[model samples]
Target chain A: MTSLSTDAIPHAQSYRGLVARRLAILVGLAAVLVLSVAVDVSLGPARYALGDVLRTIVAPGAADLQMRVVIWDIRMPMALLAVTVGASLSLAGAQMQTILANPLASPFTLGLSAAASFGAALAMVLGVAIFPAAVGLMVPINAFAMAMAASLLIFGLSTLRGVTVETIVLLGIALVFSFNAALALLQYFASDQALSAVVFWTMGSLTKATWGKVAITAAILALCTPLFARRAWALTAIRLGEARAAAMGVPVRRLRLEALVLVSVLAAVPVSFVGTIGFIGIVGPHVARLLLGEDQRFFLPGAMLSGAVILSATSVLSKALLPGAVLPIGIITALVGVPFFAALILTKGRKAW
Target chain B: MVSLALEQVGARYGRREILSDATCAPVAGGGLTALVGANAAGKSTLFRRIAGQLRGPGIVRLEGAAPHDLRYMPQDTGMSAALTVYESVILALKQGGGGWRLSAAELAAVDDVLHRFGLADLAQRQLPELSGGQRQSVSIAQTLVSQPKVVLMDEPTSALDLFRQYEILEALRRYAEETGAVVILALHDLNQVMRACATTLALAEGRIIAAGPTLEVLTPEMISRLYGIDSRVERCSRGCPMMIVDGPSGQARAG
Candidate 1:
């Protein structure tokens, strides 16, 4: 029989130390995210001082009325929207990478955002509503509906008898191309007004972010975080491989389905609200993976924080890159995400994935 | 009192039946059982059948152990996860129902298994950085950290060096003896099987040809039938039993 030894103290301490170190890294990411959000809020056409914005946020009634209105009513929603949407998309991508066992798998790459864009373009160009009851809120509702449909399609295909991960990824790419082609066809038949609206919507902007949208996205992120946290060990075990995870008493198929369903909602809600901010879904989880590894406990939160930081920083860049005009956030994200992703791949090489 | 008995346990991938009617005696716990077979002889298929990953026709009966108490480590060494050795072992240990936090007992269990498997020094090394032999040892640690009552490991020592393989097999034997686990490991090295395993199960072409004590189940005729190779069972200068391979059996001819 193996008994507890004096050396056990050191090993346990070392492990505890490692855990503390990871948690500290998470705290650092959260700090960076907070600073990014603050900087994101401080920038805009009005150009409020950072100190005034913080004071207005801390004590709304005592601050200047104009600054209060600008910071809390307008800028705060946009900034928080970036945070929630970023966290949602990143968590969705992280879990997608986990369940599908493909590092390239993400809400954007798997055609959910493309499907949402198609849905939104249909509403803008053809005045078509996927869900008739929500006709007044046609664009976002239709986007949510079509995104769910696409996610469910992928989920259903994944549950088939013999479909592999590569097959799912290939199917997603096919969906992306098919939806983009269909969207182009719709744009071709549209009025100039409708066409311009469709084009701008595809560009992806945080300028139209509202408090209601922020609340809905934040609520969804809150709902999904605990569910992913509860299965943290199982999700981490899955990275070892499906067979090993199943052998460890993890219901692999069920877990994957559940996670896919959650990922579907997570990706669907944010893309519906924010149009098509696509890069966070692909890059956020990878950043978290590079830093925190895939221990879902840390990786989950790390992904959310990293995504929030990246997107909030992107939002700030969108406003800061030009003097008064807000550049399309999508262009900035892609421009930034590609170089950062490439740098990570080049530096870490094949080890990080 | 833990025991594992397979009655007509069969598995298939689509239409190709890999294992068929593989019945064996109730192998008792507290010792090593070697599963010896050729490359295409359905050793992994049998383990998958028993592990319940594949289903066709089978009755995998266990005594004094629940299905939940079983753990199967497949013969895969391509673990490319970014988790370190300690984290990977802890991941296995906390599967099924652990909460967010790790308890002291859990940490002790992981530490004990790592040290037992000679993986303590490499505890902080990431999985992708390890060599094939080191990866196999890490796999062994991951498999046993949970302290399952029944264990199935396919080709567990295939990638290990000679000394590491021997040491791991000995550690597994001791682990089985201490915990009374029904441990079955698929191994290609028959000499290692003879040295460590108390019971031997011979599989050939999806059939369980024999199951008995290592010496009784492994013979010149049985070796020939299993691998299409002519071999001799002899003793080394240290009086340890060893398999001496001569050549391919007369039944097999290379084209």
Candidate 2:
């Protein structure tokens, strides 16, 4: 009896300590993300010193006109885009993994990226705009439209009475194949210039990022994060399995549908703006899971920060590796993400998946 | 007293009825009740019907408690999450309500259950790292952490070892007595039901055959009808009730 009483205080204290530790890890990831973004802004074809970059970012009017324009206009947009897009995609993937109960479920693996690619290809190759009014922004608009269509398809099918999580994931894979085949068909009949445009879009780059794109992505992230935060406990409970979660009064079907819609929007916006950046969705969540476990209060922010740090750091590597020439950001993400993710998986004793 | 009464509750899958007319007396709280049946006898289906996971034909009335005041623990305890034992129990306790932060009382409740289930030592261990029996114990803690007015468990101890099973049942009985909760367990072992549960509800082919005191409801004839087995209920040297199965029933073999 005495032992039970004595143990209570320490157990409560230890759980609090665990929460503190997870918070510290989240802070650490955010710090790394900020540093990497700074480095990403500093390095380019026309490189500036780190101090000048920091100073210019802090006080834009103090820097010279050329430095200000170059940092703010060119490099800063790409860096900020990396953070927002990375955060958005990673958050999408984390929730997808949660709702689907599949470790491999992500924006890239489950056909959102493929659908975006096909949508962009249609706009580029055939000069066909799915939404006729957006002439100036046909590619992104069409891409978003198609990605939303595919996600809604999954979401619609999942709401049926007997469709399981595995069925949803399988349906996602089927969508991946269907979209990829259509993309291939579009490529076959494309003009040379249009073909190159489609190919470049599929490779995924941040070079053409604009401030407007960054704001939109960040706004979407802001909107979605709070919605997810409100259901943090429910999302965490879901990882235990569907029946168990439902038994806990979680309204499992409705929650899964809600998460799917939000995730679709989260994934669609970024892929539309920045093309198909693949590995961030899959790797970011895994990294956060490895560090912080699956508590959504911590896992949600942790995934966003880890993704931002990874993509920001990848942006730095893309600029630094080929000095005057920036490599395709997609290529570098897979190259850097696979080995780093493999190492984490191989080394970690805890089962992340 | 908290009580759960099912009146003509019926549940079915597509084109096939699983449970029909499962009526039970108003079982008041503060003790263990066993729901026993053979495979495909609709034990889990009945629990689901009562838990509101499935839409059935009849009424499940609860007295002195709302629907949310009941928790059902399904048999399958397969967990692959990266959360620790402490966090998983915390997850269950914080299921429907509460904010991001854990209250001191909430933490204390979780700790109390963990200590009761002998899981305080494995508090920091990850879910995927624990053994099968340990995972079952963790699931029990998850079910009871909320201290619900009515608790339904479907084969909760199937994965537990002998000693662990006894210890968990003892903890559960204490919980029901202390909290005045209606605790119903779907168990395959008739002997364990005889030892731990005061009341037993026997089902055969999706129909409630008998419901009353465990000893009266678990007669050799009832066991034969439910499980197609010839069994005898005997007292051990320590005066504890045990079931001694003779063989498959002659009627079952002929049919």
Candidate 3:
């Protein structure tokens, strides 16, 4: 199939044009990202300058040991960690829209985030996290399994022989309530420290960002990114109704199966690590739409970057915006994202939307 | 050979049988064959079966080539609000491949069709921005680009204005004549039936009440029985027929 060589591209020029546009957005975002990292690293501890932040990163020994450790070991990983989680949540949001055919859907709204959080909660709160003498993939294995199960149940309920957007939303709402109820039950049984851990986990923070988790998240994201971009078409096609998609030779069920699995897998990883970060999934794509226009190709890339940009900025702003202390990353994301999307709603209203 | 034929096709969802012993055969030459019936008369059920998106009790044979050569555009013509008109058609073209990518020439051909249907200006607009009529138009346009041997459409004009309705039906007619591709449309409007259709299939309660030449199959009795309303079909000038629904005033012509 790869041999088909993408019959869509007329020549390298058109292909290059799309690639150039995508790369331009990526590059611009990357530069801003680097700047955000510097700003974030310089905020606390030794308060390195922008120049020192760079020197501390690359020139290492040029800076004192303490500044280097703070910059390299702490802030830099947090920034990268924030971007990865942000990308995953937004992409999951986009996929949720496609699968359910509802504009208002997000993994959090649909309960995937809460469900994964519950999985992680079960491990920590209940001490049911099985780390074995034998081979085991640990929390991620359980989280992904539970997340997939949660999503499949939602998919099954929303879908009869035929599905409507309203049905999916209602099912998602039901799942969210029930899943949160289950979390409450788990919380009720937890020890005080475990409960505090679960509660703080749901608020989402970059504080837990570690080198190991960043590597795993990046590797998984890099592998899945192409498929995520390509999914825009399938998503649009599926909205036409899975039956019609099948008639159009889309292998509708196969596509849905793979997408559901992929989105669930994607959702589980980040939410397991970052907990239920809100609005990134909902607002990232909307921001992408406003900036790059609504073409899914543009929308997907736009969403990915808008997500990274917002989270990167939030990572910096969370530390600096407050007088003396850091805020949870999710709090800043929602505060910024809510008002931006609110303005979008007010200006457009439901009809314009 | 029939372009699309269903034999003894019976369909049901849960406990309710929507269609039973329904058989449909379109002329091998290919043009619009309008399926007319009142709401819930098994028109949609038959359409789904013909599209092969839904399986029923019959073997659907495709003539002049592969059985998989037909496509169906459902009533909703499901569209992602996020995609562009250009992206929508490209995906339809890519039906055979896991990815739907249209080459420049292919895209140009699709753009031409979109242009003909007055969708050219909105090619880059998001699907969410389109009106119901425009969305339906884009859906119909996407179906044609695959160059399928047969295209099945449900409620093709149920959402459009009079002018857009005529525009869409006329476009379908032109495409059919140009490519000899059969078009099956389940229609709510019978005037469109006489105007654009060469054949008519009237179905009710899972049975094909009548199916044949458009003029003969769509008698006043046939329509009244299908719709459960008092109506009449008559021969009109210009070698075209028309429907007159009986009302309190007198005999009224239904355009």
Candidate 4:
């Protein structure tokens, strides 16, 4: 008979240490986010001192009126939007990877972004909108609707075939190609001015960041975080494969459907508001998985924070690169993300889950 | 004592009948029972039906334990490459109602199971890094850590070396005896069944042809009929029965 021994005490202690280390990483990510927000807010056409920016943030009415407007009305919303979009995309990507059990799967890889772009193109070029009236609002609404449509299509196909990970991923790839072709067709027949609008929208920007968009994205993220957290253990179980997870008493089909819907919401909202910011969805989760292993309790939040940090930092870089011309946030993300992704692949990606 | 009873258990996959009218004598807890059959004899389908994974017409009644107390391990271990052996075992415990965090006692119990399976040294290693036999052992450790009342395993020793297979079977037999759990395994090794299992279930063409004590049910005629091979049943030096196959019989030899 095996006896209860003190040997397990060290394991408990190490487990606690792992939790503490993950928390520290989270704190460090939060610090990066705060610093990026500060830097992004301070740099622009009219440079505001960091002290003045801080002062205006502390008490909005006390600072100079123009300075307050610049910090609060303009830059603050954009920076906060960066955080929201980043966190949402990252968390959604992490969920997708776990549920699909493929390390390479993400919202972008699965064609959600491409489908959203098609919807936005349709709204901008043809005036075909999901939400009529209010010209500026139609793009986000149409984009969100199309993204959800793509997710549903994938989900429906997988259900017909018993919801295997390979089926979902294969169908997602097919959706990506189909949507991209549709997007190309739209661009080919558009007027020059409309074509340029469609092109700029596809490039992705934070220039349209406003309080309304921020509020909507933040609300979606806030509402979905707890739902995802409640299913954290089940999501972790899914990494063991669907059959194994089902045998472990997890309702595999229901969990997969719920997680797919949540990921669509998480991905669609941000893409609607800010166009398609690509790499944060894939890279954020990889970074988090590298730092904190596959424990969903920490990995989920770590992914969100990592995405937030990457996007917020990119937001700062987008403006700081040139004096008055802001680089496209999507372009900057790709440029930065490509090298980092390559380096990760060469270094830690082989062994990473 | 607890027992498991199945009445008229049948299964099919898209009109291909895998099992039909397969009934078992009530197997009491605290012993190893072996389900032995040929390649296409529906051993896995029957096991899945018992594990509640496959839905079919059946009445699987447990005398003293709830259905939730039964755990099934399929032929494929399905261990996640991302999770270490210890984390996977803990995940299994937590999934089985151990709550959000593992208590000290739970951790110790997991450690004891790992040690029993000779997996304590590889506890921190990822599942993909281990050899097949080691991975299978870890999977068994994951199942046993939950301390279920009924354990069903499909080809649990399929990947292990001969000595390791013997070791794992011995540990499982001891575990069943100590906890009074009903342990059922789908096995191919006739020698293992003869040595380790208290009861033997012989199946052919989706039906149970014979079921009783291992020595009594596994006769020379049953072996020849089940496998289409002429075989001699003899007693080993230790007085346990063993089967030695002579050759293919009748139509098989003509072909």
Candidate 5:
């Protein structure tokens, strides 16, 4: 018989260490977010100093209309929108990697984003179901509907043949190509107004983001967070393979489906607003895994925070780089995500992150 | 309450029947059972059938209420090398419901299992960092941590060197005694068959050649049939019965 128990050992040190590390990360994220918002507010045709903005936020009576408009309408919406989209995309990407057990598997890898792009394109270009008299906001409606529809399509296609990992990924890739082709066709036969709309949709933008869209997307992601996190333990088991996973009571098939659904919702909601923001899903998970280790408890939130940090910073940069011009959020994310992805590939790629 | 029986158990891969109507009785309660044979002797296939990994009508009966009562350590270390030893063992315990609130006691037990096989310091080490022997040691610890009533280990020591092999076999025997778990391992090494197993099931071409008490069952004729060579039954230092194959299908070997 063994003489010692982990219970007998004092792990206060480990606990303290983890707590400190987590707090540091959270503080760093908060600092970056705060700094980015500061930069955003102090920018544009009318600049608001840090002291002035802080006082305005706290002592509203002292603030002028321009300051109020800058803080509330322009900067606040952009910052909030960036945080929401970034967190949702990262969580989806991180969970998909674990579920598919492939670091390369992300929102984009499963064709969900491509399908969303198509859906967004169709709504913007065709105005298919846009009734100018009633709900003039057809693109958003079309975007959400088609994004969810694309998600369901990928889900259905993967499960149509019994959910094997290889089959799911292959089907997702195939669907991605199919949806991209459809989007291409939509692009080919568009009016001048429709052409720019379609191009803008593909390029991705958070400039049109409003509090309503952020709230809706946030609600969906919040609902899915638990389901995504619940599989942390099972994802650990699945890495051992299906036979071992089953042997361990993981219910491999059901877990696979649950993960697929969770990721789809996570990806669909974000893509509904941003179209196919490539690499956020792919690189976010890698960053999470690398920074927080492979433990899902930390990986999930780490990825979300990392995504938020990247987007918030990028939003500020994109706005700064193009004065009085709105750069596509997709390009900013691509610029930020691609180099990190290459770094992940160069380093941890061989390490199986 | 813990007995396993396989009847008319046959398996196929496409057109090839790896195990054909294999039948065996429960040998003994405590020690190892060497399902010994040549490379393609269907030992691994039989283990899979028993473990319920491969679907075949094998009239398989396991006494435990849950499959966790039985453990299968696949020959392929089948564990992802990307994970750490702590993570892998934690999974085995999780499956067994060893308890989610891993107190110091339980966590120590997890670590101790590693230490028993010289893996104490390597608990946090990733599987890829492990040598073949270290990986096998971790795999064994994962299998035994559940205190499984029946653990079907396919070549548990196949990856280990000579000394490490003994360490693993000794660990298995101790585990069986401590937990009273029925341990079955498939082995190609005849010496290992002699060292740990209390019984032997000699299989050749998807059929049992001889099986019973390890002493009586492992004979010159049986080893010859299993290994397809001229063999002589011999006695090791501890008076345990073993076989010596002088050459493949040649003569003049006696012990």
Candidate 6:
């Protein structure tokens, strides 16, 4: 009996250790995000010292006119926008993967990106905006509207069919292919200038980052974070299986609908601002799972921080890659993400999910 | 003692009725009851209705506990491959406790369950890394760790070897006796049902064929009527009733 009691001690201690380790990883990811933001703000055409950037940020009006404008007007919004979009897309991806019960599922996998692109293409090619807004804002509004439309379509269909994961996935895939084909048709008939504009919109750059865009994305994130956090336990239970989650009193259909609406908002807002920044939504959650397993309490925040870190790092690298011009943020993400994703599959892919 | 009473329970899938007006004796606490039936006999459908997974016409009432206190374990053993055994048990406890953090007592209960199920060594192992039998054991441990007032298991011993099956059934019987929880198992094996259960509810084509003590209701004629087989219920040298299937019934063979 004494030996048996001794055997049980390590199990409890190990669980505590697991919790500590997850916390440490979350803290470490937050630090990486902060560091990446610092690097992103410092590196540009006119370089600013890290100390100066920190000082300027701390006391915005105290810095010299040039320094303040560079830090506050130009670089700060871009860095903040990267963090917001990254975290939003990643959290959405994490919830999507769980609710769908598919590791490959992401914010874009359900045709949100395709729908957003189609809407943007319509604005650029046919000069048709959903609302009569300024040219700078009209495309994004249309794109966001179209993405939500796709979400509503999918949600309505799944509801009619009883809201199973299989139904959602199959219907989402059908939408993806249909939207992609429509996008192709639009690009085929466009004039040279319109076609170029459409192509650029799909390339997904951070060059369009502004304080207004940053605020919008940040506001959306703020509103959605608490909602997601409240459902974190139910999301964790969902990782077991939908039936099991329902058995545990999770109200599975309602949970899926709530998650779907949130994911649509998360994916749409970012795609509207930054274009189609792919791979982070899918890869960020996988990286978090590799680090912290499937406990949603940690997994959700871990995915958000991992995404913020990756996108901020990529934003810095995109500027550095070209001497005077910024490389497209989407290209850098894929270049970096694909290799890392491939390596993850080779090493831990078989058992990680 | 707590008890579960079902009255005129009926279930259907689409337009086809699976269970029609099925009723059973009030299963009292501190006793292990076996629900035995052949294939497509609505055994699982009935269990689902009791588990609240299916919306059927019935009044499933508990004598002394709330509806939330009843726990059901499905036969599929839907364990998450990503969660370790310890984490899975913790998730179960959190679900039962309805809290974010586990108290010291709750954590100790999880550890005790893991140790009792011989899963202490594999507590840190991912669930998918274990064999089917090991996963089943972990599933059972997860159910028990919740400390439910009533426990329902569907084919809980289907994946176990003979010794492990006996061990698991014995452990469940002991737990029911100690906690006075109404324990019900949907089983197919006659000998296992007779040995492990004090009461038996035999189902046939969605109707109750017999409901009484295991030894009394599980006679040769009842077995034949339920399963279309020629069988005998006799006492073994250890004085436990055993089932011996002689052959198929004449009508069954002709059909």
The best candidate by TM-score is: 2
Per-model TM against the reference:
0.95, 0.97, 0.84, 0.94, 0.87, 0.96
Clashing pairs in 4: none
Worst 10 residues of 3 chain A by lDDT: A1-10
- Candidate 5 lDDT over residue span B1-255, tens digit each: 466767778888767888888888855446777788878778878887777777877688666435657777777655553556776786677665442345555565666676677776776676656777777788788777766788788888888988889888998888777766678889888878887888888777676667787767777677666565777877778897677778887643221
State the lDDT of candidate 4 residue by residue for A1-353, as single tens digits.
12244344555445556667878988888898888888988888897778988999999889989998889999999999999999999999999998888888999878999999999999988999887876668898899889999888877776774557887898888889999999999999999999999989888999899998889889999999999888777788888777677767788888888988899999998998888897889889988887777878878888999999999989988998887988889999999888987897678753645
Q: Is the docking of candidate 2 incorrect, acceptable, medium or high quality?
A: medium
lDDT of 6 at B140: 86
Ranking 4 against 6 by DockQ, winner: 6
Q: Return the TM-score for chain B, candidate 2.
A: 0.97
Where is the poorest 10-residue window by lDDT in model 2 chain B?
B246-255
Predicted candidate 3 versus true structure: per-residue lDDT over A1-353, tens digit per residue: 23244344233234335546755876786687667766776776445577778777889888888887888788778888888878777777776776665667787776787777777777767667544431244455555556767888876764465666567678768878887898899999999999987887777888878888788788777877788667656655666666667667666655655666666766777877777677788887666655554446666666777777788888888888876777887788888768878898677532313
Query: Which lDDT value does model 6 have at B243?
Result: 90
DockQ of 4: 0.41
> How many residue pairs collide in each prediction?
0, 0, 2, 0, 7, 0
Instruction: Locate the minimum summed-lDDT window of 10 residues in model 5 chain B.
Output: B96-105
- By DockQ, the best candidate is 2
Which consecutive 10 residues in model 6 chain A have the weakest lDDT in total?
Answer: A1-10
Clashes of 5: 7
Which portions of model 1 show Cα errors greater than 4 Å?
A: A1-7, A348-350, B252-255
lDDT of 4 by residue, B3-112 (tens): 88788899998778888888888888898999888887988888778888888897888877788888888778656546667888887777766445657778787788
Record all residue pairs in model 6 with backbone atoms less than 3 Å apart, i.e. clashing. none
Task: Highest lDDT: give the candidate number.
Answer: 2
Residue-by-residue lDDT tens digits, candidate 3, B60-97: 77788576677787787545454567667666776555
Of 3 and 5, the candidate ahead on lDDT is 5
Query: The CA-based lDDT of model 4 is what?
Result: 0.84
Q: After superposing candidate 6 on the true structure, give the runs of residues whose Cα lies further than 4 Å from its correct spot.
A: A1-8, A133-136, A350-352, B235-237, B253-255
DockQ of each: 0.54, 0.60, 0.35, 0.41, 0.32, 0.46
lDDT of 6 by residue, B169-252 (tens): 988998899889999999999999999999999888787778989988888888877888899888889998899899988654
